[model samples]
Each structure stands twice: as C-alpha cells, then as structure tokens.
Target: MKDIARVSLPGLHKSSGGFKSARQVLIIDGRGHLLGRLAAIVAKQVLLGRKVVVVRCEGINISGNFYRNKLKYLAFLRKRMNTNPSRGPYHFRAPSRIFWRTVRGMLPHKTKRGQAALERLKVFDGIPPPYDKRKRMVVPAALKIVRLKPTRKFAFLGRLAHEVGWKYQAVTATLEEKRKEKAKIHYNKKKIIVKLRKQAEKNVESKISKYTDVLKQYGILV
Candidate 1:
C-alpha cells in the first residue's frame, strides 16, 4: 500500500494507458472528391478517433445523372411529419449538410459512442475563415474528375444544392444583390425623410415667429 501510494503520476503513464495518445485533427478538401469514397474514408478515420474537418463541401461530387439525382432529393423533401416538423427525417438542402448525411449513413450512429464520434466531424460549404490558410489533405482514391472517363457525365454537389433551393450561389448574385439593392433603396428613403423633416421644422419655426410678432401688436400674447 505504501509503495503504490508513493508512485508519482508519471510513473503510472504506461500502466494507466488511458492518456497514452491524443487524437489528431485532420482537414480534408472535398473539391472534386467522390461523395461515397470520401464518406468511407471519413468514417474509417472517425472510428480511429481522429477529428475531421471537411471543407469545400459544395465541390463534392456524386457520380449520377444530375436530373435523376435531383428528383430523388425532391422525393426525400416531400417526406415530412405534418403534425410535427421537429420530429422529421429532416432531409437537408445544403451541400455541406448533404455530405454530412452521407457520412452519417456510413457510421454506426445508433450507439452513444458513434454519436460522439460523429460530433467530432465538421463540414463547411466553402473555404471558411481560419481553415483557408491551413493545409488540406487529399485522398487520391476518392478524386472525381480524375476518375471520370471522357464520355462519362456526373453531377456536382454545388449544382444539386442550387437546384434544391440553396441560396448561396457564388456565381450568380441573385439573392445577395437583391438584398443589397433593397437596403440601398431603404437608406435613400430614410435620407429623404430626414431632409423633409428638417425643412418642415424650419418652416414651422418661421411661421411661429411671424405669429408672435402679430400677436405682440394686438397684445394677445407677450
């Protein structure tokens, strides 16, 4: 008992085995990467306890006819618990969410430990800040554009997301530009209102002074 009590924490490093190793953080770029292969690799790494951050999620690829795949998504979207939208099979429209759902299907997410492992995964739509400067890893087995034959045709996640009502299209300034223009119009209206208010106040003050002078002569007001 005395010998065990005297043993320092460092002395028990090998015996304890709990804190022997730390999990590594990994960044994967999804640009032109196959969705199924990427999901498989990510599932394997998550099982190994590595924290994964997937970027360029909109650039991820699904090898199928674009229109057919989009129709499938529409079918998924049509499924909704009418009584309660909260308890839903919640099909996501965003590319990042779609990629994440693909990864979840690969994992044993029914268990508590599996849920924790899934929590370690982070998915981003584009080169978000902080990750933009970091080095990203590429899996050669999962490349889409390279794997495709000259005659083959497939859909990209970005296009699929747009078809499914994803408003963050970097190419077309449809939603964003409209919002900016509306804001400018609002600001201009506010400026006009302020200018008119000041002019009205000045006219009112001049009228009040003239009335005061007239009243003084009549001794109605002092």
Candidate 2:
C-alpha cells in the first residue's frame, strides 16, 4: 500500500540502503540531441505524482550546431517578448529551467488536482548521491532511448512527464510507444488505488469515531 504513494529519488539512500519506497528517483544522462528525449521521460514520471531528480544534464546529446541553435532560440525568445523590449544585448536561451519548464506545460497541472501533484518535481545538473559518491545511480537502460521531436504535442506531453519527475527507462528493448503507454497505464492505476485508499481510510475513521463516542456516552470504555 505504501508503494502506491512512492515518489522517485535521484540517487541511492545510505541508511535505508535503498529507496524510501519501491518507487525511485529518475536520472538521465545525455547531451544536445538526446536532451529533449531524456527530458520527455522525466516529465512523464512527474505527471504520475512521482518525485524526480535529473543528473548530468549538460552532458546529454544535442544534434545541431550549438551556436546556431542558440541563435535561433534567442530569436524566438525575442519575438515572444521574453525580455524587456527596451533592453539591448540581452537575450534568452535554453537553461535547465527552460528545458524543465517546457516539459511542465505538457502536464494538465492547470487543474486543481494536478496542481496538488506538481509539488514533487526536482531538477539538478549532476548526480546528487544521497549516501555517498559510490551510491550515485542512473536510470535503467529500459527507460531511456525514447526519441520525441520538438513539436507542440510532443513538447506538451514531455513537459507533463517532467513536472511529475518520471525517470527514463529504455532498457527493456521494447517499442517506445508501447513502453510509454504501459507506464502511463501503470501510473493511472496506481493513482486511482491511492485515491480510493485514502477515501476508504477516511470512512473507516469516521465509523470508528462515531461508535467510540456513542460507547463513551454509555459508560463503555472501548
């Protein structure tokens, strides 16, 4: 039952010698071209109410000319009025926040319920070993290797996963679409169970309290 509420952790736990729950932290390592893919995976987990932590973000793959890409990004930002119009020599570009924030938009967090789950995400540039340096971990190969473009839909979906702190796991050698859909179903099922359990607990508590109060009034100490 505790597993239902599990959130992802970025690295190994020292004293516990494992995760606080079976659920773990998501970690990705890549550069440039692969960065978007990795981010997509992370964002997926975040949407499922998991806590996520990213590592070695700068090393992720990038497929294009770095300078040219930066220029294009800056131009886009300029057109969007991302900076003060009066300011000169100022430009906006990709940073971890930009990358992660983009993924957040993919989520349905505008809803009150989603906003409640949005508090679990965390992003970092390098391994944040909880116990020791040796304890640092990486995402399973099954979680990585998903390739999504920068299209609007992809960006939206990827950001939703990011906000939830999902990890990339491409190690199973399964088709990308299948693995993602499976993960999504698993996440949704777990969420439903957790919600139902909370409601059940509340109902049980209410019954018990009501009975106990009645007994007390009748001089029964149960």
Candidate 3:
C-alpha cells in the first residue's frame, strides 16, 4: 500500500503533468489564417498544455466557394432537436465563438484533460486592450495566402458570421468609434506638445532680448 501510494502517476498531479511541461502563453493573430488550419494548430497547442489566445477571429479566412460556405452554414442551422428546438445543438454566429467551436471539435472535450485544455484557450473577435499591445504569433502554414491559390475563392470568417446574424457590422462600427476617439485624443496631445514647445522657445527668446537690452544700457554692446 505504501509503495503504491509513493508510485505517482505521470499526469495525476498538476505540477508533474503535460501542463508543467508546457506553461508558455501563445498569442495567435487569426488574421488571414485559414480557419481549419488555424484551429488544428491551436488544438494541438492547447493539448500540449500551452495557453492559447487567438485574436482578430473576424479576419480569419475560410478557403472555399463563398456561396457554398454560406449554404453550409445555413444547413447547419437546420440541425436542432425535433421535440424542443432549444434542447439543442446550438450554433454560434459570432466569429470568435465559431472558431472556439472548431477548436473544441478537435479536442476530446468530454474528458478532463480536454476540458482543461479548453479552459486555457481564448478566442477574441478583436485584439482587446492589453493584448493589442502584445506581439502576436502567426502560423505561416495556416495563412490563407500560403495555403490557398490566388485563383481559389475564399471568404472571411467575419463576413460569414455577419451573414448568419452575428451583428458583426455593429461590432465593427463600435470599434471604429473607439479608434476615432483614440486618434482624437492623440492629436490633441500632439497639439498641446507643440504649443508648449513654442511657448518655451518664446520665453527663451524674450530672456535673451532682455539680457541684450541690459548690456546696451551698460554700454557693453559692440
């Protein structure tokens, strides 16, 4: 009994498992990335115990016929419990939630490890405050430009989500307003800085002129 107790299982403890092996936080920029490819990479990273944050989910691309993709989404919406429609295979319309669901499908979400991995994953529609300042990692292999040929048609995740009642336009409008406000603040600050600089220069010039006048009064000028 003592020996068995001392023999610890590999993943039985949090400090000794896959979580300990990979504790790094990975911030992924989802812009221009192929949805499936990005989801696959993120799923693997999450399973390896790395905390993954995917930003700009709206910019992620899906490589396929745009119309076909819309049709697919419409078909998916048709799936629901017959008895009570709400009982329900819920479908997410937001790009971030759509990406989250994609990654979740790749993980064994019913199990404890999978749930733990899911817990470490975060998907954001846009780059939020602190994360906006952080350096984001990009997967070259998962980029749409690299994976899809120029001739192939592709649709943005944001566009698709918007079509499916995601209110993406409203969200983007809000973000635009915030950006404009920030720009206005920055411009005001610059104006203040320039005004202060001119004031200081005038002060220096006035002081120099006063000193020159004092020298003239003393008959010290050439």
Candidate 4:
C-alpha cells in the first residue's frame, strides 16, 4: 500500500506519517464530479489504506448521452445465469451502489487486501446527518465540468438510475418528509421553551411586585 502522505490531491490535508491513525478519515463530496474519475481517485485512496467516505453520489455525472446510458443499463439488467438467475450476477439500481461497484472494479477486489480496502470505503446517495455536518473534500481533477468538453453532454448518475427503475424520487420524497417532520418537531420544542421561559419570567415579576408592595406597607421600602 502506498503512503497516503505522499499522495497529494486537492482538498486533502497532508500529514507526514501516512495514515497511521485509524481516525484519519477522508470525506469526499461527489457532487458535480465524473463517476469514473471520482471512483478512480477514491479507489486509489482506499488501496493506500486510507478510509474514504463519498457523499452526494446522486450528483455524480457520467459522460455520455442520457438515453444511451439508460439503454446500456437496461442491457446490463438482462445479464443473468441461465441455470439459476438468482444465484448469479446482480445489478444495482442506486447511484451509490453504482459508484461503489465502479470503485470496486478499479481495485483488485478478488484479493484479501482489496476486500479490506473496500471495507474502508463508504458511499452515500445524499449527505446524511453527521456526514452532513462534516466538511467534505472535492477532487479538482474529478470534477465533471473541469474535465468534460463544453460541447459534450452527460447524464447524472441519479437520473440514469431513476430511468432504470431506481425509484429515487419516491425515496427522496420520503426522506424529505422525515426531515421536515424532524424540523417541525425541533421548532415546536424551541417554541415551547421560549413560552415556558416567558411564563416563568412573568411569574417571577408578579412575585417580586407583591413582595415590593408588602415591603412598602411595612415601611421597609419607599
């Protein structure tokens, strides 16, 4: 395995001693990046024994005609064992899975070291929480707009996956609803806290006023 310290790339902080610490994790933002290019970079990092986490995989782009990409995926879906289709090859419909598979292809996945390297890689469709709060790095070399020609057309990995029956929209909608619900709950809790704080302040003011009156009547306060 190559030392991660020697492999310098954009957005990756350099360290002298390589990835000696297990806590050294690289969070990559896959938004607006070419799928193959991004996967290749990530595969290299993983092979170097560095843990890599790729988020926003849905935004990854593939260089080609959108329709032709869908057709290729459709054809891939048709591949199966004649004897037992269930026991043979499987196709992934999710963009994250597609990216993961792409990275796997770049590695020596059949070997134990490759398998271990793959175990260190994590790919996500969207920026889920914890990761959402974390800072994500971008590979300048892997950016679609940076590498692709101005006249060339491309398809988003998510869109291509959806065209092939990924149900991305439905899943995203559900996740959106859950996020909205959580936001609403948090807002309501904050409102309740403010209301309770105001009520407590009002009660304290009333008690203070009563004590002042009693003190004035006793000629203790003027």
Q: How accurate is candidate 4 locally (lDDT)?
A: 0.83
Question: Each prediction's Cα lDDT score?
Answer: 0.76, 0.47, 0.82, 0.83
TM-score of 4: 0.71
lDDT for each residue of candidate 2 in 107-177, tens digit (9 for 90 to 100) = 67788755644565655433344421322344432222334345412122222223333243231113345
Q: List model 1 lDDT by residue over 1-222, tens digit each.
A: 222122112322323322233425667889888888888888766665657899888888888889888898898888999999789988787888899999899888999878977998999877665676566777766788677775777888989998888878674335345545766797899899999999998889876988888999999987
| Candidate 4 residue runs with Cα over 4 Å from true position | 1-18, 173-222
- Residue-level lDDT tens digits of model 3 in 1-222: 232223223343333344453325677889999999889888987787767899889999998888999999999999999999888899999999999999999999999999999999999987787776566777877888888899999998898999999986577758857855876797899899999999997879766997888899999984
Off by over 4 Å in 2: 1-23, 30-33, 80-94, 128-222
Each candidate's number of clashing pairs is 0, 41, 0, 0
Candidate 1: regions farther than 4 A off: 1-23, 171-222
TM-score of 1: 0.65
lDDT for 128 in candidate 1 is: 63
Instruction: Give residue 73's lDDT in candidate 3 (0 to 100).
Output: 98
What's the TM-score of every candidate structure? Answer: 0.65, 0.43, 0.71, 0.71
Q: What's the true lDDT of residue 167 in model 3? A: 80
- Tens digit of per-residue lDDT, candidate 4, span 112-210: 989999999999887678786566787878888899998999999988888887887567647757765876797899899999999998879866997
